[model samples]
Target chain A: MVILFPSKPSILACGAVAGPVERKSVFYSFFDSVIEDERWGQKTNEQGHSQMIQEACDILMKKAEINNLDVDFFLSGDLVNQMTPTNFAARELAISFIGLFSACATSISSVIIASLLTELGASELAIAGASSQHNAIERQFRYPIDYGAQKPATSQWTVTAAGYALVGKHNPEYPSIIAGTVGKVVDYGEVSPFHMGGAMAPAAYDTITSHLKKRHQKITDYDLIMTGDLGKIGLKILKAMFAQSGAKQEELDVLRDAGAEFYGDDKAFQAGASGAGCSASVFFSYIEQQLKIGRYKKVLLVATGALLSPMSFQQGETIPCTAHAIEITME
Target chain B: MDPQEYQQLEQQMTPPTPYLKNVLKAFFVGGIICTIGQAITYLYVIFFNFTEQTAGNATVATMVFIAMILTGLGLYRKLGQFAGAGSAVPVTGFGNAVISAAIEGRTEGFVLGVGSNMFKLAGSVILFGVASAFFVALIKLILVSVGVLEW
Candidate 1:
């Protein structure tokens, strides 16, 4: 389902910068939600996206000036209530229209919407962005803890920061999200919400495999086959599922679930994160790295967003996941 | 960035036991967490004469309260020493993190201290919570528009 953003908008130029918090705060510049405190420290009232939207606008404005956009559609949101921070930030930016979305895969969501609009000739350019904060995050999910708790090794801490990737015509500097296959949630009827990463892993594999199936290719075809935010369990489970579907073990490099890994076990379990921005932050960081190193060629950056609610959790219903794979190529 | 502190945290993260041991611990603890959740639900129904839905809310609240208490008493550490993800993955664990932050923040000052620092480890949790809700709403909007869902 295409949201409000345009298709394949030409990214005139893109830039990323972080505030003075810490090196890790750089992550907030990408994803909408991130806890300010590493699992080892104290907390804050700042929503993860709050910090991100601020910096994202600074970057977006500077980039917009350079890219020639006085006013444009602002499609942005985080895993926060009503997208309050994002909307507030959008108001400050004075954009034409704002579309809020909760696909934890905001990075890809932004890209997909922008790309589709750009390709459809709806608009020449647009911007997609997100950020996360662990402080606000921790408060929302669980009550406020003022001290240390016994956390397991699998637990991962959410990172903080916001990042924005500009969309315009294909340039060597900025990239475009090309031919993508939308993912559908297929409930084998066994996956659970608590085990969201695990549940979505198969859907990711299914989408990737289906994309490959259409092109008559396999996991071996791409330099890297990225899944949105399947953390340790999901990653492990996905590999097993892929193998079950006949994908070889040593096939491709997958960069996923990065934010929590940065914070480590002081805050998370299952060695991963649960939210929208998990994949967004990692993919943003990785995309920049890939572009810089020229290590990316035909990279399938598939972003995933979990579709679950309190109602679903209450009903003992499983999480329904959706993924969209956009091919980023060097050609 | 203190080397010793980093070392301590690093050590804390490393498992003292093998995966099998960890898995067994996680299974029991996780099962206990789930049972506690169910128990709370049951308690809500039996004592308060609540429905399954209201009881489920009680279960979540109970779990959060227990985790918060454990985080304060510093007793959850013992549980984590034994169980792994079992104690980590649930809402109880998220509760532990926020309460832990508030506890740590209390020593800092007051207004800007504990109150501001209350949600430390949970920033992303809230961020994504809101972001995901927006995404969910959008999806619901699209689904309803296309007749995929009635919401």
Candidate 2:
């Protein structure tokens, strides 16, 4: 369902941090920091995952010129079991925490909740976002990090990164959230976990089409309609779906995916980047910067997530996917 | 669209797997691993007074040890990705699986983590290997007992 924020809660500031391997990302310059070590000098990957989240929150607070006590809530999640990394970071930040789990869409989902809080005058300032670490997430979802398992071309590389955005009262100068859509779980009977994009494309299509229909807006009304982590093939499938619905070629041209173009045609990443952090880092950094620079006047950020646990996948269940979207306008 | 129709459309849109290319890569990489094993067997025969039959055990052990080292060094995973089943079908792949699981479980602690998880991936291989071997030997014994096969 689409929720209109009459108050138009603004994203006051954003902070994005990535691991060592993400230095090669096309939008690397947009990131606030890229640590030289994937572990971030932590003893374990989980510790490093927590460190990455803490670093992102710290940077967000620093950018907004606010301390942890000034923030009302800390909303975040990751792919780790029970989201321990985010939980640990929340403990350190000491902000009233509400951990969310919309899978990869947690970035936007958290922001949506924070925006709702801001609209209701319940929160003055809140930290909201998501994160993922490759080693930590991979070991849980698939195989051990050092295990020699052959992945299909449809498989996506889980990135190690964290992104947090500071949401507060609306400011005319910043990108303000006007409307948000909390997506429904859409399952098209896609069984292969390797082909996540195929499973999630229908959910994204459903959410975007319904969001536009509800808001009485056309696809061309926004400067961009970017999906979170639908890799190269997923993006193609999304486009095809739109085409089948009689969307014009030019209208479809505005569609883009953060994961598809993340590594800039590096075949090593296979289909493209995945994980919770993929959308979080790109949205809070690159897309936010683009809005600030007037490169995009209005945009729709739809973060899609495959909601399947390792146990569910092993039990021969199909992947149920969801996509959460927020319409942001720069005035 | 219905799920069945959507699945068909998705299948149409997705690229076909490069089976021929993958098979070629697997063949070459598997051959290279076997060639290395043969070289180790020859070395055992020439310098260690090991016959062809006796050298088999030593070569297998040596290959697994080398794979364990490569896995710890974080290089075997890359090779596995590049070569697909080529790097996996060999005994070295078994070594990589066990060692990798052990290394992965290090974060959880020693007893419950590394020790128990060391066999997480390879346990199936061992179970099936022993079971099949026992069944095959049982069939042979039955045949020999009935004079249907030579002992």
What total of clashing residue pairs does each candidate reach? 95, 0
**lDDT per residue (tens digit) for residues A179-274 in model 1:** 667677644443244445545665676677787777666676677777766666566656655554565556734534443343344332445654
* Model 1 DockQ (Cα-based): 0.11
Tell me the lDDT of candidate 2.
0.95
Residue-level lDDT of model 2, residues B60-143, one tens digit each, is: 999999999999999999999989999999999999999999999998899989999999989999999999999999999999
Query: Comparing only chain A of model 1 with the true chain A, what is the TM-score?
Result: 0.79
Q: Write the per-residue lDDT of candidate 1 for residues B1-151, one digit (tens) a residue.
A: 2334423433443344477877887888899889878888888888889998878777888888988778778677567656767887788877876777667566457777668876766777989999999999999999999998995
lDDT, candidate 2, residue A92?
A: 97
For candidate 2, list the clashing residue pairs, or say none: none
Please compute DockQ, using alpha carbons, for every candidate against the native two-chain complex. 0.11, 0.81
For every model shown, what is its TM-score relative to the native structure?
A: 0.62, 0.98
| Worst 10 contiguous positions by lDDT, candidate 1 chain A | A1-10
